[model samples]
Target: MSRPAQYHLLSLPDGSWETVSCLASVIRCRATTPTVIVDVSAVERLTIDALAVLVRKAMRLRSAGGELLLAGPGPAIRKVIERTGTGPLLPDFYDSAAALRALGDDGRAWQRVELSEGESALFCEPAQSPYCRHRP
Candidate 1:
């Protein structure tokens, strides 16, 4: 089977400024594919520096022939993106399933994995067991 694309979850807590920069750098260094999925559901606020870092990282990913997909961005972050006129630079935005579908080769290969102990469901790459190292 083809390897699943790397997935990144960028949760923005109240003090995400420091965290976001570190995450962005990690993604830049570790990702082999140009495609990255940034999950921003946990973000409550975005600072200018954080936003700039995100934009720069996204651009760098694209220039390297990779794409960045954003998901779970809160209203605050959305507003920031709009106000800064950076929406165009953002890659496709979608909820979890949509994001996975967008990444799949056939657009029809994805599955939802129910978490153990009633945690939450995670989208899994088609034919791969959820939460497996190869499933991301």
Candidate 2:
């Protein structure tokens, strides 16, 4: 995918079970960018359970011939990600702009994408979503 798409995830402030729960449908929507970026700037900390959600989403995107990268982890959250030993798997950036550039998105601010709506982040899905777990 040339000029891979970029999608942003709302920062999780509390990292609590409730915050995680509320993100369920958004993460499982099966419609995201070829390069989904989970922005963690506003997030202060991340739990193992919370990281699991990210990994699952990344895996789902990967299965569809795409990839996922974490963006902007603060000092505390950076410690959590490193201590968890999932750095190689999750691959984070210092900030979202660098992440977007890494994904080949250049200065295309018009292509900004979001995941909370439960619809395609950049465009609508086809009749059968290639990333849908239900697909056989």
Candidate 3:
């Protein structure tokens, strides 16, 4: 039989470009993991750019035989997900724990993604692009 899939848990701060870049690095490091559950409770609002990041990552993960999940989005964010027609692309759960349970945790200790300042890089688009406003 194949090996059991490993689950990696990460929490996003907000839907800013910074968060998107941070997520890009974090997910890159843990790309081999089968499941990535991102805690979005801290995100007050998910912007289109941020949503694009999630969708792109989710598609990449799915193609690699893995999955990405959004957990703990508020009502407004939920509406955004549904209205944007990304509900099916990105599976969301009530909370991280619920997501873990749905994936059959088996009590395994999962690794949590921590953001490092030095590794932040812009993954959205060319930083010089005038349309990308959230640059630092």
Candidate 4:
């Protein structure tokens, strides 16, 4: 029988910069697991620096044969990922159930196209639209 995958959920506050770093370190150190899920649903205000940290950490996890999934991120945090080109770096970005589905079922790689020079950050109005307002 196959063993169950290990998963970790990290919930960050609005301005908890250290938590992001700490979680990254944990993921780096805990390399035995095949899956790690970070739930940033409570993150209301995330800066570019924080996103960079997350991307780098996720990359490290991926390099070690582990996948980092982001689940139920708030609008602000999601916008940061969309704006800073970090979403593509992640294995999967989705709601709770969708994230679970993507845990280890490697059917296809999610669409992770790189953004153009003039098509980076995207700003969504009212925070309800599925699409982002692309900005140069």
Please list the Cα RMSD from the true structure of every candidate, rounded to 1 decimal place. Answer: 9.7, 5.8, 6.5, 15.2
Which candidate leads in TM-score?
Answer: 3
The order by descending TM-score is 3, 2, 1, 4
> What lDDT is obtained when candidate 2 is compared to the true structure?
0.62
As a TM-score, model 4 comes out at 0.64
TM-score of each: 0.66, 0.67, 0.73, 0.64
List clashing residue pairs in candidate 3: none
- lDDT per residue, candidate 1, 70-129, as tens digits? 777778888889999988777546565567777675544544322233211232222222
Give lDDT per model, in order.
0.61, 0.62, 0.71, 0.58
Candidate 2: which stretches are off by over 4 Å? 1-9, 30-34, 105-110, 114-136
The worst-scoring run of ten residues by lDDT in candidate 4 lies at: 119-128
lDDT of 1 at 136: 27
Instruction: State the local distance difference test value for candidate 1.
Output: 0.61
Tell me which residue pairs clash in candidate 2. Answer: none
Off by over 4 Å in 1: 1-15, 104-136
Off by over 4 Å in 4: 1-4, 91-94, 107-136
